[model samples]
Target chain A: MKTIEIKHLWKEYGDNIVLEDLNLSVKAGEFVTLVGTSGCGKTTFLKLLLGIETVTRGKILLDDEPLVDEPDATRGIVFQRYSSFPHLNVVENVMLGEEFESSPLFGRSFGKKRQAIRERAIKILKRVGLGDAIDKYPSELSGGMQQRLAIAQALIKNPSILLLDEPFGALDPGIRADMHELILDIWKETKLTIFMITHDLKEGFHLGTRLLVFDKRRHDPDQPNRYGATITYDIPVEKTDNETLDEITGSMSNKKQEATL
Target chain B: MKRLINQHPRRIGKILLGLIPFLLILGVYSFASNERLEINPNDKLMPAFSTMADSMHRMMFEPSKRSGEYLFWTDTSSSLKRLGLGVAISAFISLVVGIFLGIIPKIRAGVAPLITAVSLIPPLAILPILFIIFGLGEVSKVMLIVLGITPFLIRDTQLRVMELPEEQIIKAQTLGANSWQVITRVVLPQILPKLIDALRLSLGSAWLFLIAAEAISSTSGLGYRIFLVRRYLSMDVILPYVVWIAILAFAADYLLRRLSRSAFPWQITATREAK
Candidate 1:
């Protein structure tokens, strides 16, 4: 069975359709990256996969079952902002998911259970190279370190699907390169089914096994929100030659500029 | 010459600079008091510093002849107890109600405007109603303080919760947190420091309500004593009692500030964000 399958999915906010005619099916342990111009419903698609937003039509099946209406532990997410809990230290932040799962009422663990959670959290933090900063608050960590903490927070839950939205867009070039290596390493180690959205075309081709390029195939100037974006190009990134990759990406960017103008 | 924008005074300079206004006020008070006393030896509007100090000493240290209680301590204690109880109850109610109102759209839609309407109705305007309902006693006085500050605290707390980033709640849910768990784990901890701050802001109004209620009807309190001495123009006793009230209020506020600082160290630190 496919790990995730979407069929004829459409999302609309009243008359404004944000995504339309989307169809995809993916086996487990595949790295899928999405790239599109701004305001093209890419983030909205991530939100839909996250189950925070409801679909207007069609269905998403996760492992042969319809997707749940809300977010849950089976899917983990990392946003550009990280969304780290300011009050909690690094270790506490990472293991909070487990705390919520095990102790549903208080979202806290005590005694031996608490200790077990702590051990698990610390082990994961060390894996992410945050061993020395376990007790430090999120404010004290640098940008790169905080992103690592965010990754650890997601990884602690052992989610089947990891959704990342522009995870490295804010980082400097040096840090972004380091992040690429780290994410690739994690994908190999865990065999996670990752769906990440990025603005950069080169980064998409370099990281994703399958690169899905989103664009609007239809538009009405009279009714600006009449048509939403759809996947225009689905490239098997590894099999594509460098010249073809450059040509496709270049044409897409030109369209992007024209649309913006 | 140092530019004012970048200039920060050293600690000693800060202390010395802080004292200048207080010294000037003292000098002016003494000058005005001596001038009035010289002109009319019986004048009571501005009592001499020594005379006021002596009255304060007697009011605080010595037991009253009729009641056999040190009036200053008893007055201070009674007022503080009422203020403490009222504020504690208001804070608890504010926290629970505010959080509910903030997270749940239905509850907020139904109740927020009612709270706003209640807050706008002057608490003092309803003092007579409270006295009529609860009677002129400790209950009425305490109720006044509660009714006065709870609305503002509730509103402040609700706004703080609503102000929290939407991402945090979604993140919690993605980690398998239910609605109740989201409130307990994510919403509660983040709103606490702000609640303490709201309490600090509301304390001044709490004290105002307390003293007003006591002034209107009470046997023993700082407010009662001050109004009691007003008939004879007993400035010496009244001035000391006033100063004593100010000191007590300042102490309570200062303690809360310290508590908020040490208990939630993260609030005072820099923002927790990545580039």
Candidate 2:
């Protein structure tokens, strides 16, 4: 069964049509990236999978079950702005789901659940290169560290699918590149299904196994029926190492001028 | 630090100096003069002050007088105990009700207008009716306190909950947090500082209503003691008791503020900027 299936998904805001009839399917353990410019419905597509924004018409199914109104432990999401609970240490944030899931209603107190959650949280933190910072709060960590912590939190649940909405969009280019590699590394290690949205074409080219390009030209705020938010242009990206990825990044610099001309 | 203290000590000095003139006038009026300052017995402030002074003199230097009656009925320990219990019980009620009214949208929408209307009613005005029904009982006093303070508490808690970040909530939801988890882990902690502030403010309000309740109906309590002293036109006892009330209020307010600061240092900085 497809990990996530979206058929005729339409998202609108009063008169503004953000996404229209966007049909896409993410296979189990596949890494798909949606890349487009801002306001191109890339974020909306990710939100559809994560169950944040409701679909105006089309249906989304996970393993043949409808995606619920709110996200569940089965789908872990990493946000762009890495603000979990600052009061919670890195491990505590990661383990939050495990603790909650462990407790059946009217179960043992918060203290008992927390202890088990903390142990698993630490193991997951180590997986994301934050072994030492598990006990540190989000504020005490660097931007990159915080993002890494966010990733650890998303992964700790061991969700079937991971949804990332411009997870490193706010980071500097160098940090973004590092995060891109880190995500690829984690995906490879866990072999988990991922649906990532990004505006940067290079990052999309580097990480995406199946690339979907959204056409911004179709977006019209004034007209409701103008275009869907995402018009998928499927592009294939060959699996490559850090060096080929760097070459793709360099070539993209030349494409920028060509596109402008 | 010394310079800051000394430079602004003028306001402090003036306040302290003002006390000396006040005590001198009071002493002269009470002991030195056979003819007392003419007080229209009908006026509230002067009569209240006069009775307080007479009670103080009788308690301190004079023996075998009205002080014994006052002491027996309204001792410091009993008043403290009753006020403490009233505050704890009423504040707990207010906190739970306020949080529910503020955070839960349906409850908030349903109760907001009614609670606001109830809040606008003068608390003291209801005392006579409450006295008729409840008849000089503790329940009447506690209920008066709860009625007086709950709306303010709910309003403050609601505002605080509204002040919490939409982003944090969305983040929590995306993290697989159910509604209950979102409330206990995210919403409660986020609004806690404001809730504590509401709690403190309500406690002060409860005290105000408590005094009013006692003054109106009771034969004991700090307020009743002051009321009984007012009948004799003893300002001395009244002033000291007034001073005591002021001190207690200040100390209680300070203690609560300190507790808020220590409990949530994150709130202090964020709440200040939000204001």
Residue B17 accuracy (lDDT) in model 1:
97
On the 0 to 100 scale, the lDDT of residue A180 in model 2 is 83
* Model 2 spans with C-alpha error above 4 angstroms: A106-116, A199-201, A216-227, A239-261, B1-83, B101-113, B170-176, B262-275
Per-residue lDDT of candidate 1, residues B73-123 (tens digit) = 999899999999999999999999999999989999999999999999999
- Number of backbone collisions per candidate, in order? 0, 18
What shift in Å separates residue B179 of candidate 1 from its native position after superposition?
A: 1.7
Q: Write the per-residue lDDT of candidate 2 for residues B1-275, one digit (tens) a residue.
A: 46765655478798998799879987765553333334343443343444656666565455436445546334444556557776776566656676677667898888889878987998788878887887788878876776677667767766777666565666666566666777777667666667667777776677788788878777567787778778976555666877787777788888888988898755544445348
Taken over the whole model, the C-alpha lDDT of each candidate is 0.89, 0.71
In TM-score terms, which candidate is top? 1
Which pairs, if any, clash in model 1? none
TM-score of chain B of 1: 0.96
Q: Pick the candidate with the highest lDDT.
A: 1
